[model samples]
Target: MKSKLSFLLLSLLFYHYANAQTAPGFKELLDSAMVRDADLKAQQTRNKLTVLDQHKLKDVYLPTLEVSGMASYLNATARVISPELNLQPFLNIPEGKYNNNINVSGFSGLAKADAKMLLYSGGKVRQLNKALEEKRQSENILLEKTSDEVAAVISRAYDQLALVHQSKKVLDEAKRRLDANRKTADKALGYGLITPYDHKKIELAQATLDSKMAEYEGKKELLLTQLEVLTGIDKERLRLIEPVLVPVALPAPQKTIDQRAEIRALDHGINASGFKIKAEQTWWIPKVQLMAASYYIGLYGARVKSSDNIIPPIPAIGYPGRKLDWKPTNLNIFPMLTAGVGFKWEIFDGREGKHAIETARIDRELLQNQKYDAMRKLTLNQANNQSNYNIANSQIALKKKEKEMANNALVQAEKEFRYGMSKSTQLIEAENDLEAAELDYQNAIFNQRRAAVEVMRSTQELDITKLY
Candidate 1:
């Protein structure tokens, strides 16, 4: 008995696992799509770029350090220094050698280091940094807008696929009803209660339902393939579990146009342009920069040999006999320091600064116009979505009423057919009406959800996290 109980429990566990493997829910698909979709991943990468831009702006005021070094070999022709007339008479030197030149030659080395810090730039650095920061903010907002757009696509696709899935179910049930009616018609013909023509009518109806079911199956497969690609799931294994939607109260809205990410990004862009104009205006302003440098240069030059030293300098008589020593001051060292400040004023640039300032002003105006236009269009879209939502809700009510009436009519027609008071055609018509009404009701629900999504998207309130 204990073994039997264990086996039953295992069977139940396997069944549960199988059920779990059948399909994925809307939330799961959405979560997977957000991470796997290529476009969304590209947008997310911009968040890292914003961080890099922030760091760049944060370090804009910091000073920079630079170090430089150089070494070179030197050479010179022989030279002889001419003796003075008074010295020549004392030393008794020949008059021919009096104008002789002395030889001079060698290697020289130098090393230098410097640092520069901005003392003042007429607020140019500050304004440029501000512009970069605002530009980064604009990019970040644009990234968020991309995310919102992608999220809306996922929402709409999921809802449309769900609607198609529901439609397939309705068609399946209709086919089943037709098949059962065909069996009844066969029995009626066997009993000679219905003619061959009536039986053929039932067969024709079955054939029509079969065609519709085949079409719906093809459509369902196509939709499943789309979902598979979107969510990065295997096409063969991918299925979408039906979502049970509950009523959700719409969140309180801000001014839709103002809160939209597109508008906010445009505002950031305008602010950035204003800062750029200030940056350009600083072009002609007096600027101050603190500069400091330290350098060491080793000098190496020929000196008179100790033995050749005399009151009057001697000229080189033979090259092999003697030559000046060639040498360097030191191997490697830097021993010098200097400090100073600099001021610069570019008083003229052929009116370039003026042109730049004008360009910035024009860009600001263009952005202002664009923001207004975007707001107007978004406001119009918001109104339309609200209208659609209201209409969908009303249509749902109408569909529900139609379904109720069709259901009642079906019951009445079934009873009449039972007593031979109604034709099979009348009963079949009632069934088709009931099926169509249910399908329309499902469509109304789907349309209502889509409208809500649109309203949220236009208002910049569509948070994927809360979609579940």
Candidate 2:
């Protein structure tokens, strides 16, 4: 049964390869996929955030400038009284001259420019800068990791599409052979050389093949669709370029776990957490800043003029009102410049700062533990992938040998049947065996490639440039 199945599968595979057409290369497919994959596009965009972070880091110690202005109007009124007494009648004077009423209104405006720089922050500035740097490092590694994952997806999808296409061709060939067998059985039955039961058996087998073909055809359509979606190629235009067969080298064992982007990202996170702890501890220390500012105030409609005044004479003394001098001297605008230093201290904050420092410390420790765990798991995974790769390589050799033996058997069976020395059933069985062996050999090649892909993924080397 296994031999028969292998025969059908091998035939389709051969048909697929023999009739394969020229199509897009792996590089083109990958480039197209990079443009269409939404996840990858988002990650690529996010990768630019690191540049913004770096720019901010560069200005960590630079002063910041701000401009401000405002305008308003004001009104005021005033009243007052005075008393006087005279003993001599020769001099005339007014006692009410000392009394007066005044009213005023004006417009006012101000504009200022200020600059401030951090003089000291108890290492908080340095810690914050370091944190940003670490964050950028983490993001960079994340971008690389996303790229690797996308490459792996494309590699596997391409291989599967190729395999399915080959398999469909093999199935078509199998159907043709079954049709021929059914025709032969019909002829034998009419000549009374074979029993009706024998003819029915051939019919039954053909029916089974047709059923299997239908199932495979559906799968082939799905595979084609997947290829279309992955490569951003039109379904009608998407065709896989044949890949050249080559021996894959065994992956070198990793002596350390730092090669993976995920591990490196974790390391960056640990560094960032350490910086955060430092920043939190700084809350208890004083922060100093230097500041400079220039400002101007202007007034409108604020002029003054001299006013004439007169008063009635009193019973004992008489006097004339004199002209009073009224002048505005502050109408001229002036720019005031000032420079100073400022300091701030949190003192205490209900233990929130302490809790923050503790939280950061714990987070750093957690990342360290996570790194250790990842190293162990990744090491094991690498070993397993290597083992699978080796196993797949060996399977190809075994399948090749099997195919050779099956081919020889089929030739001998063909000759014997022609000479009336072998039964028809034996001849057909030999044919099936040869076909099965061939199929196994071809599948073994794909299996080996997939195993190598796994090894690359484990080692963080699953790049598009390494596509088979």
Candidate 3:
């Protein structure tokens, strides 16, 4: 019966194995997954946005150019080339009167070009550039943060996989022992050396073993799926290399929070806010621009001749020789040229600019306070993780000791039962106690591993560059 049950269990294992998925190790799976991980992709996207934002700052300091044209016919306007209006003081007397003359009907056309390049904005551009650099640095820190988180998750998953495998191995050994014990009981019962109750107790213990095996199998499947999610590897690509059981070293109590990424981000934020304050204060100063431009003017206008509105008369005495032919004017094109510099002194804005600078100053202070706040939080969290890790390590050691003693007691029980000196119930109880102790030890190890991973996450020292 023992052989038959072993054959059946082996067959089931083989069937499951044939259908089970295979996976690569944590590092290899992470390598494949980093390409597809959404968190990494988001961080990369943020980095690109930061780059674009930095490039956009250049436009604030660069030149602006524009072109335009205006054409209109007026019922009354001035002539451009009138001698009196030409800035010749002696030609400024009447008709061609003020160097230009008013006509009851005329038109004018203009093509204008203008350019302005800022020579100075009172350090606004410089301050903004500084702020942008800070922003970029902060984003970079966030990238590191994401990478660390990914590494920690992979670590935890690998730990779980290891624990399951180890526990499963221990359970397999227990199962084999129970099967052998049941065989001995069966032989003794048939020889009338033991009661049927003893045989039944042995069978019950074996059944417990089978139940535990089934539970381990289910747990293994669940663990595999969880690992798959963490690494982002497809079902086929993920494998777990034997995980290292290296002990974690406790962090020194004297380590400060300055090296942490959260604190760094806070520092950058403070710097960025300082620059923001400078940028706002720059708005109170004068702005100077250098400008030069040239353009072509083309005029097109038509006054439909209303010759029918002309009244023919016979007033001949005033100008009998003045019946001259009327002349027609045509549109002409000409070149327009210009050059200049401009200055704007914003002497006052009803205190708006002052308030703006004041507001920015307040914001700078706010960021400083936030930085301190973040520093406190970061230090607390790191300390807590360190403490947890140390506690878990101690717990693992203690549980390992407990399991050792339990195993020794169980060994003695088994030996006594092999002779005629021990109750089947007492032996089974000792055996169960050993299994429970082993389970507790395995759990402690798993917890210790999880805490160690958390420590790495807190320190931002997890190997996350591969996620890039």
- Note each model's CA RMSD in angstroms: 6.3, 10.8, 9.8
Tens-digit lDDT track for model 2 on 44-149? 6786886777687667669999999998885665554642234235545534555554544577778999999988878877887788789888887887777777
lDDT of 3 by residue, 317-366 (tens): 34222211233465555565677888888887788887887887887788
Residue ranges of candidate 3 with Cα displaced over 4 Å: 1-23, 68-113, 237-240, 244-246, 250-255, 295-297, 304-329, 456-468
Candidate 2 ranges with C-alpha deviation above 4 Å: 1-22, 75-105, 119-122, 172-187, 210-217, 234-237, 243-251, 284-286, 299-333, 345-353, 390-441, 463-467
Model 1 residue runs over 4 Å out of place are 1-25, 76-104, 233-240, 245-254, 298-334, 408-430, 463-468
Q: Estimate each model's TM-score.
A: 0.77, 0.73, 0.78
lDDT of 1 by residue, 118-197 (tens): 77878877897888788888887887777777677777777676777777777888777667666766766777766787
In terms of lDDT, which candidate is stronger, 2 or 3?
A: 2
